[model samples]
Target chain A: MGEKKFAIIGCQHNHIEIFIEQMYQLGYSCAGIFEEHDRTLAAVIAEKYEIPLVENKLSLLGETIEIVGCASMNHEKIDVIELCEQYGKSIMVDKPAVVNQDGLARLEVIIERNRIKVGMLLTERFHPAIYTLKQYINQGKLGELVHIGMRKPHKLNASSRPAWFFNKEQCGGILIDLLIHDYDLLRWFTGKEIKSSAGLVGKSVLPEHPTFYNTVNVQVELDDGLLTQLYADWHTPSKSWTWGDGRIFVTGTKGFAELRLSGDPLLGSSTPIMLYASEEEEWSKVDLIQPHATITADFLSFIKGEASLLTHEELIKASRAVLDADAAVLYKLIPSSKESEPHV
Target chain B: MGEKKFAIIGCQHNHIEIFIEQMYQLGYSCAGIFEEHDRTLAAVIAEKYEIPLVENKLSLLGETIEIVGCASMNHEKIDVIELCEQYGKSIMVDKPAVVNQDGLARLEVIIERNRIKVGMLLTERFHPAIYTLKQYINQGKLGELVHIGMRKPHKLNASSRPAWFFNKEQCGGILIDLLIHDYDLLRWFTGKEIKSSAGLVGKSVLPEHPTFYNTVNVQVELDDGLLTQLYADWHTPSKSWTWGDGRIFVTGTKGFAELRLSGDPLLGSSTPIMLYASEEEEWSKVDLIQPHATITADFLSFIKGEASLLTHEELIKASRAVLDADAAVLYKLIPSSKESEPHV
Candidate 1:
């Protein structure tokens, strides 16, 4: 098969660097880059990588690139969606595909009309620990799924990004930006749909941020008797670059497993995954899997028609669930709006 | 000094049994027992111990009891408060002293007029691990406190508790009943007043209970830079009376510590407490201190004027903070009533 050509649509996302490295590693030819406006790091990185920086999104359509990765800021998602539909290109957008329902519906309608393949960058689905977890559940190793608890707490840079990034209207606050990662993962792992969700979003710290909430706690009821609780925040003040403290704990009728990604920066540290069973007296270490690389590889394989998407409809459902949670928060924050009423 | 006498009021609270045992251990004589219209477990226990079970609140006034311990369910708090005030007795009510602001205000007024000591049974304040956590902060062992996280997840019996215990207006949901324990502890440890709080409450699993929410998540900002998040739930299927699957994690500028308590009876067969620290490479065994006994001992000494109440005003403030969070949830849950307007 001819080597697939790849291009990036935006430069405001944290995962752009990782995406670029993955593309090169996978032997995909770097076609070009597109940025809506000039930015220092985007320009410098594009120049350093010897890739063309297209001034307009339409210019990418003229290039022979087959896959466009949307790594734009949360507010700029609508523009990326428009470009993808215009070019009839298969695309993958970073998490929190769109902040509000209107933007999400617009994206959905465009994709439906274009009949193009669309994927969400829900890397948690590809996490080695999570993959292993899914394998165990499928094998009935943990017995009937009873309860799921997940936490994704990370520290965000105070200086980076535009001021609008902190606004609720722009990003849908922490529930979408931070907690949605787990919301999607919870739905993926439990194999259950969220019946109803209630959440709390408020400014616990960082009052300088424009949003009313910096932390969120959400309880989601699955179709089965399983209950999932998700706690997420961006208020931790650690200075580490790769500070993703993600933990997924599942309790079954027979046994339970707790998976955690180390927050410490010290590489070569072997303690990452842990599993415990009712038959055992201690938590045994499980072999770690590379989630980020797996996600990239899986997306490429899906593009090549080798494997079906690991999570597609689940992603949409998860996104909608997160939006519902955000609506709950907004209802609490701004009671004046009738649109914030609970759907259930 | 004359011997101090105490009366037991109600018995719906979980800690009542422990309180009675601790009172015996601390050598306090029961003056009487009071239950408004029904005979409760507290009255039965009181009668078994050869204490009088008074049927009328007015009769307690002539009994000369120095203190009244109100461990009634939410609906009975107002009558408990009035009876305590009428008898000119110092009072100690369970956490979430009242569900509504009007009831809370009335209790505050009665306490002010009677000029009597009032306390809330914030048993966490006397927890050895929590006390050690407080000492760590006071000694500046972990540098400036930055973030606090707590989890109080438990699996309760499906058929326990009265219907009113689940009602939003009656029990104030899980935020008040469960999360308030951590709220009081956070205020005590950080010595910071809660600036504001937002929370989510729902009955994700146990729909059988009609009155109260089964799950809750709350985030609060202290006056200091410290941020606190608490998760409380009552829907886990596993049932163990003497244990809980909960963890409290406190992070400081320099270090972090994690204390996990599991209700699995099997763990207690070998070790009582599991403690871990960032400085340590593995979880270690730690001695568990009985908080109920410690609190009862402290109260006995405090009543004798030998020691001060360990958690008094701080408990009240925590209860108020949690009540505010419950109000936040109710505002989100119910349709917009005239009371839904933000008073702050």
Candidate 2:
């Protein structure tokens, strides 16, 4: 990559730091950052990276930047992407790049009209445990995949969150905002398209935020009849050793494997990949080979017309899958008595 | 707890051993054991308990036996229970005491007509981790439970299992056979009744057993709007150190907890109760207080019309739950192309 540069179009979410850090790792300079509203972390990031904080986002997008990184509020991400596409710049943003079905439709039209690469920060794909699990799947350590179960429970810092964070119109529901990573993992590991899906969302806590669902579960049936179940919640206890207790349990024809993406409490900070194959007498922890190729590098390579490990299609497919799941929410549960009444 | 004596009416499943062993633990004698077909395990149990291997089941039932233990094939279990009920003998049997909805209806009628105490061995209730987790929940360590996720993956041991085990009509599907434990745990931990549930079953492996489903997933909505997800399969690798890699993750309003019922690979044989409470600084492994009272003791007490820790109601409820789930299986998959073809 020669003289690669990217500009931050929005910094509403802390996930923007992922893009910034990855860009710097790949020797790409940030031309400038533009956050319409003042965010403490954005300022911290700007000072750390020594990048100018621009007052106007369009001016930053107009820079001779190859990519526009976005971590805006869920609803505002579309405007950033559209502006980047108009400027002939590729884009990278956090998952659920589009909040709802309407935004997804608009995204489809933008991709149809533009040739620039667009990707989401599905950071789980870059985790060492994920890389190892993929290698095991590829090597047939686990025979034809049968099912995958994922649990992603994150701490919800209610007091620290912005007011708009609780609005479904702005933040999207938990399924799209949180479970998109699980959908992407399901597709990537099984190498199959989602044939059908059913979802349920509930607000067990945060009674004040009626529009925001704190608990969500989705079931996906793949084209080849492989099954996947994902449960995501913003219920990680404040005192959790890790931000989340994320896990992936894969069952195959001949064996099974478990990948603890966030460190397991029993195992401390180590991300352990536990495999129990039909040929092995006991479960063995596979040593991870830390991945050198970051998603940012791959996205930048794809933008610069070079070989890339990541593909543009899966990103869109994952987004579409999650949007469909969000749309497919079977039950809009009433917080107290779900048994007698489920309204819309 | 006088000279109580129990007879094994049919000893097809190895789980009969639990009843016999526990009866002996509580100082009850086994009057006799009657197996229509010679099973190695039945013979082993007869030898271990020093019980007579009777030629006729009726003769054994007539031998002043207060309790009749049945671990017969899934379909045959109902016949044994019915005979025991006819003889006015209290019963303790393996889970899914009755297989299908028809059998479940029969069970409800039997329970209404007979005063004999009947219980299924949901032995998970006796697990150390389960006991500890229940304590935490009851003590409000995890304040108002929000959601529960369970994974129960067991080794199929296909060749070792009986021919009838491969027949769905005889053995019940994976959900009924394996996930009854999960349903029972869900009710036990949440202290909430299941309001509505949806289930999906698929067979990704074991192609030859067309009648059986090897994979199952169920989403349950509780009365208080608490959600639960359960995934169970008959796909545990033969060489796995443990029979299953069972896990229960509980999310509550104030905190979260994880119970590794079958020891985690990383934690080895020690079952760990991990809690991340908002009041604590970090995740703490709770010390388990091993229960002196076993499921067998509770059943014996219930049969004797004495105070019992176990209830007669939850057993029927769990059976009803699993049967409803089995009946509620939405898609009858076509194995290869679930996308184009969902037969049911």
Candidate 3:
């Protein structure tokens, strides 16, 4: 296939460097980079790669780009989506796609009216070890799925975030920002609709950001009697960054498989994905797949109609699960103020 | 003090065998074993140990035992407390000492009136590796405490117990049954009161018991701004007689430590404690201490007046924290019933 041309929108995210590198490696030609403002890292990266940085989103509408990669951090996703829709370009947006149901629905309607290809950035699902694990499960290597547990413990630098990132109304807190991956994976592995879920969300150490929840734990029940538990937080101290780890564990009637992505400094900057299987009787260290590359490839394939990418329906469903979990934390599942009062 | 004599009350818990071996090893003479009704295993163990089987609670009270180890799985701890009060004997009671607030209050009144020594069997607090970690923190080895995460996953046999055990009113579900260890440890390590907590609790696969929450995930806020997350479940399948694996990860400003405790053969267990220090150059394996032995030693030391045991005030506070968390789960922190809907 001929190389596809892509433009970048909302270059305020941490993964922009990885995205640009992956796009280049995948033989995709960059058309231009567009941001609401100039002199951002996104613009710098674009300039470093010798790509034109377009200042206005509207200017990219008539460009030769076939796709736009939306890499904006939280709260700016809605604007990115609207611009992508206006250009009628296939787009890949980072999670969470939007902060609330209203924003999510608005974006959904826009994408539907334009018939533009839309994909949510859930790069973890494309991790090479995760892909292999999915293949193993599909081959019935783990028997009938029984239970799944996932932990994503990330330490966010309190000093580094855009102030809006910590506002509940802006980012939807950690449940949405961090746990969207869990919600998607629960559906992906169990193949069961979520029957019910409850979550606990609140500020941990970041008293400076009282409106947002920095820590959250969610318990979800699936349609087929599978139970999934997820714990996500941004409260670990700075010194423990080396031990920052992400794990996915799936257990079945026959055996289980565990995939751990370690952030230990000894392992270096590149996180190795290690997979342990009952059948294999040993844990095999697997090479890491550049998630951004896989995601870009998948998006391109979907746009070419060569393969079906994660559909908007799936993204909406996953988004709703995360939104519902957050709502459960904020309104329904958490105790009322009066109820929280100590009795004695 | 001369060799102390002890009697077992309610010899029905799964840990009764371990208690028996521990008592023997600790140089305590078995006054007798007592249960409401006789079971072959209990009778056999008592007989094998050359300890007579007492007929009832009255016989246990009437014995010359200086200590009573209430190992009953039942939550009717008030009766045991009353017996210990009447006999002026010290006691170690298996936890969830009383299932409800009223029962707990009554036990408290009786213990206060009798002025007898008591120990709540919180063996997890005394777990060797956990104690070592505590020591490191107490000595400022880990620097400023930041965040703590713990998980306990287990499988219970359907034929194992009476139906009442699954009832929240009776056994207090997974929160009190499993996560209490974590709750206690959090308070122990932080020396801070739990200001607030929220939890998600629900039944997943154990359809036989719909009312009981087989899984729980709790996020607790401490007065010191420490965030702690705990997960507990009793629905994973077991391959052998052993079930459950536990992990505790503590992250501090200076370093971090991760502890894993494995379950029995039919149940999964955790790996031994692994300690990682950023200041130090290596990851080291720490020794595991026998928890029950430590509990026994603590009780003995308290009885000898060499050290003060965990006070009633501490026990009540810890129990209150656990119960409050459970209540949060039951009430659904948010007011909307729809938000409490399960996803699975």
Instruction: Name the candidate that leads on TM-score.
Output: 2
Candidates sorted by lDDT, best first: 2, 3, 1
When sorted by DockQ, best at the front, the candidate numbers are: 2, 3, 1
lDDT of 3 by residue, A65-145 (tens): 777777775677787877777768778887788888888888779757857877777876777767667766777867676
Candidate 1 per-residue lDDT over residues A204-283, each given as its tens digit: 34546535454556666566434466766563435333354566777665556767665222223434664544323344
Per-residue alpha-carbon lDDT of candidate 3 for residues B117-230, written as tens digits (9 for 90 to 100):
777777777777787788778888676665677877676666776676676666667787777677888888888788777656655345466456555667677775455677
Q: What DockQ, between 0 and 1, does each candidate earn?
A: 0.08, 0.61, 0.15
Docking class of 3: incorrect
Judging by lDDT, tell me the better candidate of 1 and 2.
2
Worst 10 residues of 1 chain B by lDDT: B333-342
> Per-residue alpha-carbon lDDT of model 2 for A10-97, expressed as tens digits?
8878788888888888778898888877566678788988988888777776656778899888888888888888888889988779
Is candidate 1 or 3 superior in lDDT?
Answer: 3
Positional deviation of B67 in candidate 1, in angstroms?
A: 5.9
